[model samples]
Target: MVRRIETDRLILRTVTVDDAEDIFKWASDPDVNKFMIYPLHKDIEVTKEWLRSRDIDGNDEFDLGFVLKETGELIGQGGIFYKEDLDAWAIGYNLRKEYWGQGLVPEAMKAIIDYVDKEKGIHAIVGEFAKDNSKSRRVMEKLGMTYWKDCQYSKFDGSATFDAYLYKREF
Candidate 1:
């Protein structure tokens, strides 16, 4: 079963079919999808379909939605994409524009890193950010992730390549 993680300000939990409306609200915003690997969700049905296929029990890596503890508001989504070759996990997160400057992403990230470290016996966690996304890069730095390398990676749209900075932190 997928577990729930609580941070000071947010709750990290598995996405459910009931979360479709919330997912659509934030995911359909073009601004939120700007740096994401996938485009803004087109409609509620699309979001529901995506949620239906996210089998957290079977997948080694799966996505989870972030919610505000006090308000019960869905803020965003994040997950660890396990990398077997490196024996590490690649972390990714996206926050709604309204919550951008509140320092919630790092709060959520800390809970995830801590959980994976103890439960999964993770040695390290890594992440990549588009070179131009200064905010995200700062979050990596805030989480103590060191700059490890740089490379060009394919964009979500599959139309072109973009420069990205790789960051990592050992447990």
Candidate 2:
């Protein structure tokens, strides 16, 4: 089972079926989805279906939602994607527009990184962000991730693509 992690002001926990509405609220926002790998979800059913497809009980990596501990409000989602061949994991996260600039993402990410390094025996954690997203790049740097490569990443809209910076941090 996925474990719950607590920081001073946030809680990181597994996504649940009941979280469909909360997921839809932020994920459907075009601004939030602009730099994300996937397109903005069109409806609640789409969000529900996506959540249903996730495997929380298997060895597959998990995605978690970031919640405000005080109010139990969902603010963002992020987690590690296990890469067997690399013997590492890739980290990713997205926050609600209203929560931007609050330093919550970094806090949540740091906590998760600590968990992965200490409990999961991961050798390193990797991440890639659209080059245009300077905020995200800053978060990676804050987590002590160093720039390692550059490559093109396909956007949700098949009509175009953009450059991305790959980052990595070894344990």
Candidate 3:
């Protein structure tokens, strides 16, 4: 089972279709999705479909929603999933633009890293982001991840592309 995680300001737990409207708040925002692998959700149905497509019940991958503990507001979502091509796990996250620069993502990520390391016996994981995403790079740095290489990644629909940087950390 994917464990529920709590941090100083947030709770990270599996997100479901029931959370679609709340998730759409950020999933539909272009600024929030500037580097995402998926296209901007055009409607609530799109978000609902996307959520339904996730591997929410799988033990090896977690599709989590981050909720503010104080307000019970779902700010964003992220997850760690095993990548067969890399033989490792990849981590990704996003937050509401209004919550940026609050150190919340890192706090949530730290708890995830700890859980996987101690409970899952996983030692390493990687994160990659668009080269121009300085904020995401800072989040990787804050989590003690080091730059690994550069590559190109594009949206699944091929609508946009990015020059990307990959980072990795070992426990």
Top candidate by TM-score: 3
Stretches off by above 4 angstroms in model 3 are none
Model 3 worst lDDT run, 10 consecutive residues:
114-123
In Å, residue 108's CA in model 1 sits off its true spot by 0.5
| lDDT per residue (tens digit) for residues 50-160 in model 3 | 878877668677667899999999998877887778777889998999999999888888787777667566767899999999999999999899999998899999999
Candidate 1 vs. true structure, TM-score:
0.92
When 1 and 3 are scored with TM-score, the better candidate is 3
Model 3 alpha-carbon miss at residue 111, Å: 0.9
Would you list the clashing residue pairs of candidate 1?
Answer: none
Candidate 2, residue 102: lDDT: 86
Candidate ranking under lDDT, highest first, comes to 3, 2, 1
Q: RMSD (Cα, Å) of candidate 3?
A: 1.2
Root-mean-square deviation per candidate: 1.6, 1.6, 1.2
> lDDT score of model 3?
0.87
Q: How accurate is candidate 1 locally (lDDT)?
A: 0.83
